[model samples]
Target: MPRGKQTDTKLTLVSQFFYPDTSANANVLSELAVGLEERGFDVSVVTGQPAYAPNDRRDDQPRREMYKGVAVRRIFSTRFDKNESTVKRMANDVVFFLSAFLHLLFKRDEMGVLLLPTAPPFLPILGWMLSRVRGYEYVPVVLDLYPDMAVELDYLSEDGVVYRVWDQLNKRAYQAASLTVTIGETMEETLTEKYGPCETAVVHNWEDGSVIQPKEKANNEFSRKHDLVDPTTILYSGNHGMHHDLESVVEAAATLEDSREEDLQFQFIGEGGRKVTLVRMTKDRDLDSVSFLPYQPVEQLPESLTSGDIALVSMQEGVEGLCVSSKFYTAIASGQAILAIANEETEIARIVEEVNCGIRVDPKRPGQIVSAIEHWLDNPDEMRAMGERARSVFEERYEKEEAIDRYATVLRRVTT
Candidate 1:
C-alpha cells in the first residue's frame, strides 16, 4: 500500500452511468476515477451514455474520450426512459451489461484492478464473471443491496425463485471481490449479516464542500430564478423512487396547505418513478405551496441546494440499511437542516442525532413530519444553528478529499 507501488496499479471502473449522466452513482464514480488518476494510478472508466439526465441534457457523446485525465470508454446501449417503465429500464440494464461485457472481454489484456459499482445490479456479477475469466482483482462498491431492496419495496417476493437466484449471484460476487466497499455502517452490517464476513470498507458518499458550500439564497441565481428566496423552503432534492417515502411527504404538504401555511413551501427537485404520481397528487390537492422542478445542472448545485431551509431525506420503512441517500451528504454540505424520514436504526437517522443537524421522523408518518416542520418554523434560531452544525460535521468527516483518499487506500490495498 506504499505510494510508490501505486504507480504501477491500473484500475478500470465499470458503471452503467458516468460523466454527462446526472445520476448519483455516475457523479460519484466519475469523481473517484479522476481522483485515482491524480494519485498516480492509471485509471479508466467503462460507462454508458446518459440515461438518467434530462432530455435536453442527454446528448450523444463520443464513444471514447479522456475526462480530467481519466480514460472514458462509452458503450452503446438502449436509451430508454427509465422513469416510464420498469421493464424498459431493465432492458437498458441488460443491453449495457452485454455491451460492457463484450467490450471488457475483447480488451481483457488491458483490464486490471476492476472497480465495479452496483448501479445496474448486474455489474458486480459481470465483474465476478470477468475476474474468473481474466484473473483480475475486482472491488465491488455496494451502493444499493439488490434483492433486499426489491423485497423491502415489495416488488419481489422473498419466496420467489428469481429472488433466490439473484441473492445467490450476489453472494458469489461479494465472496469473490478482493474488497467490498459500502457507503454506510448500516450497509456493512446488512452485508455481513446476509452474506457472512468478507473484506469490507465503509467509505461514505461525499460532495465537494468547496463547490457545494452554503450560499446566500438572495444572491444565488438558481434560487432567484426559481423564486425560492422568499419562502421557508423544505426541499426534497434527488430521486423520487419507490424506495423513498416521498408520498408521505406530499401528503404532509397537503395537510400544511389545508392549514393555510402560506409562508412554508415544499419544493421537490429531481426525477424518478413516483414523480408523475407526486405531480398528480399536487394537482389534485391544488397545493400552490408545493412545487416540482427538474434536476438542475451540477454547476448550479450550490445555489440549488442552499435554496432550502430544511432538506428532506427519506427511505421506505423496511429499507433502512439497503441504501443510504447520497442527498444526505449534499444536504449537509449545503448547510441546510435535515428532516430525515427514516427509521431510527438507519444511518441518516444516526447521523442526524450525532451531529444535532436536524430531526428524524418515522416513515409514512405525515403528522410527525408536519410537527417537525412546525417546530423548525417556530424555532428559526435552532434551525439555523442545526444547519451550521450540519456543515461543520460535513467538513470534519464527509468531505470529498477524505473519501477519495480512503478509496485510494482501499484500491492500493486490494491491488498490492
Candidate 2:
C-alpha cells in the first residue's frame, strides 16, 4: 500500500474465467499466477465462478478459494443456457463485466497492478476506467482482437453502428492501458495499426511441458481405450469453433475416403459452434473414417494428444491476426507433426516454418490438406522428424517457464 514498494501489494488478475475451469484461458492464467507467486510476488485473482463444463455450472461457487497457491475471489454472475441465443450470451458477458468492474472498483486500494484479458472482449475497458480513477496501472492482455473478430465471425458488420461503437471503445481501452500484451506478432501489428501505437508486447501462449510431453502412440492410454490403435490417425483437437476451418478438414476426409485404402481416421475431440455442424456433415456424408469425441479432461491431455500421428490446427482465412489457436503449442509439445491451415503471414505459420515443425497449407483448399495428409502417410519418417523438431521448438521457445518469465517481468516493470 505504500508508494514505491508495489511488490508488497498483491497483483490482481481480472478474468471472466480462471482456475479449475477447463478452457485454455483459465489454464494459461493459472500457470501465470502460480509462476508470479513463485517469483515472490503476492497475487490475487478476481474471476467468475467455474463452469467450463456443462454439469459444472452452478448458481455460484464459493466466494473465495486458493488455487495453486493463488488467492481467488469469484464473482456471482448470470449463467446463460448452453443453447441460448447470441443475445443471451452478450447478456451474460455484460452481467459479468459489470460484476467484475464494481468488485474491482471497491477493492482497488489493495491492488498494485491490474492485468486483464479479452475474454468477454470488452471487460478491459472497465479496467482502463478503474486505472484512470484509482491511479493503478492496468495492463490489457489481448487474447483476441474484438470488433474485428466479431465482424469476421459475422456476428457484427464492419459498417454497423454496433461495430463502430465497439471499435471506439476498444481503441480507448488500449490507449488508456499502461501496456498492452498480446499473443502473436500478427496480433501486435494489427493492434498497433488500429489503435495507433501503444506500448505492445507479443508473448505467445505456451504449453505446460510437464503435463503435455511426447508419448509413443502405442503406449498412449487414451488411444488404447478408444481403440485408436492405428497409427494413421489425423487428430484435430481443441475448440472446433467458428473461427477454425474445420469444415475443410471434413471435406478433406471426404475427398480421401475412396482414394485411401488404409484404416485412416480423422478424429475431432472438443466442442464448439462448428463441432455440431462438422458432426452433422460427417454423418451426412457417411464418412465412416471420421470420429468425434467430447473434450477430454486436463489429466488425459498428453495421452489424447500423443494418440495422433499428425495434428491438424486450423484458422479461418480472414481471422488471421485476431487470435492464434493455443492448440498449436500443445501439438508442438506432444511431438505430433502439425499441419497448419492458416494464413501464411500469420504467427502460427511463421512459427511452424521457423521451427521446421509443420506444414502450412491454404485454409480454403481441402485438396491441399488432403495432399499434406497423403504425403505424411507415405513418408512416416519425415513426419516423425518434423514432430521431433516441433518438440524441440516447444522446449526452446514456447515452454511455460519462458512465457511466465516474460509475463512476470512485464508485471514487475509496470508496477515499478
Candidate 3:
C-alpha cells in the first residue's frame, strides 16, 4: 500500500553528509530520502562528498546521480579529517554550508519543502534563510541542538557572545520553521522550553530490523573473523565523540579486570575524536580483555552488531537532550541487551526502563556500570530475554519504515 497521498511538492534534503558517508546522520538522511521517494514524493538530496570515513574519499563520484530513485547532488567542500582537529572539521563545515547555500540559492525556483538536518549544527539556519527568500516551507530536523551542545562540551561558554548569537539564531530559525522535528521526547521538551511553544513532532531515530536482526554468533562470519565467538562480549559500536562518557566505560572495564572476570570482553568499534585516547587508556591499563576495531562494512552490520552479548550506549552527564544516539536503535534491532550509561532524563534511559529491555546506569558512576555488567553475567537467561524484548520493542515502535512514514506524514502536513 502507498505510505501516503502522492504529492507534487518537491522535497529537498540538505545536509553536510549523505550517501557513501558512514556517519549515522548521513545514513539516516540517505534512508529518509529514498523512503520518501518510495512513498511517491519527488525527493532530492544536496550533500557534500564522503568525508566521514578517513580512508574513503569520493572526490571522483559523479556530481549528480539518481541514487536509489532519489536525485543526489554532491556539492564541493573540503574533505578534512574530522577526527584529527576541531579547526579542520569546522573549516569543512563552513565550506559545505557556503557551497550548499549557493547551490540552493540558484535552485530556489525548484525548492518546495526543505528538510534540513543539523549536520554542521547551523544547517537549519541556512534552510530558514532560503525559505524566507523563496517563500518555501522548511522542516528543521533537530538531530543535535547547537550552542547548547557546544556549551555542554565546553567548546563554547554559555555567556560567550558566540553562544548568545547562535542561540538567538537557533530560536529564530525554529520559530520560523513550518514544523520542527525532534528525535525524542526529551529533545522536544528541550526545544520547546528553549524556544517557547512551536510546532514540533517527536519521531525517534530507527534502524531496519529486517537488515540488522539477530543472528547466531556461531553462524556469523564477522564474529568468527573478529574472534568474538566465545566470550560474553560488551560492544560499544559507534562514534566515540567528546559528548559520550567513554572514560566511565573504560574504568568499568578496568574494574571488571580487577575482579578477574575472565569470561567478559569489551569491544570498541568505530572511530572518532576520543578513540585515540580510549585506545591509549586500554593499553596503559593493560586491558587484555578489551579490543578496538575499525568500523565494519555496512553489509557486515548484522554480524558485527549481533557479535556482542551486550551493547553499550552512553552520553555525557549533562548533555541528555542535546542528542540521541542512533546506535541505540541499531542495538535493539540487532537483539542485543543494552547497557545504557546515561542520565535518567535521557531518552535511552526512559526507554530502557519503560520496556524493561535493558539496564541503565548513571554516567558518573563507573561502579554502577560494573554492577550492571555483573548482573547480566550472573543472570544469563534474563539477559537473553531482555535482548529478545529489545528486538520486539524495536519492531513495534522504532523500525525504519515506521519512522519514514512518520516523516512523510510530517512533510505532508507542513507542505499542505
Q: What is the C-alpha lDDT of each candidate?
A: 0.87, 0.84, 0.87
Put down candidate 1 lDDT per residue, 214-298, tens digits, no spaces: 8777988878888888888899888888888888888988887787455878999998888999999989889888999988878
lDDT of 2 by residue, 370-402 (tens): 999899888989999999999999999999988
Each prediction's RMSD to truth: 1.8, 2.6, 1.5
Clashing pairs in 2: none
**What lDDT is reached at residue 347 by model 2?**
88
Cα miss at 129, model 1 (Å)?
1.0
Candidate 1 displacement at residue 314 in angstroms: 1.2
Candidate 3 ranges with C-alpha deviation above 4 Å: 3-7
Off by over 4 Å in 2: 1-9, 58-60
| TM-score for each candidate, following the candidate numbering | 0.96, 0.95, 0.97
Minimum summed lDDT over a 10-residue window in model 3 is located at 1-10
Candidate 2's displacement at residue 84, Å, is 4.0
Q: Is 2 or 3 the stronger prediction by TM-score?
A: 3
**In candidate 3, what are the lDDT values of residues 306-384, reduced to their tens digit?**
8899988988888888999888999999898999988999999999999999999998798998899889889999999
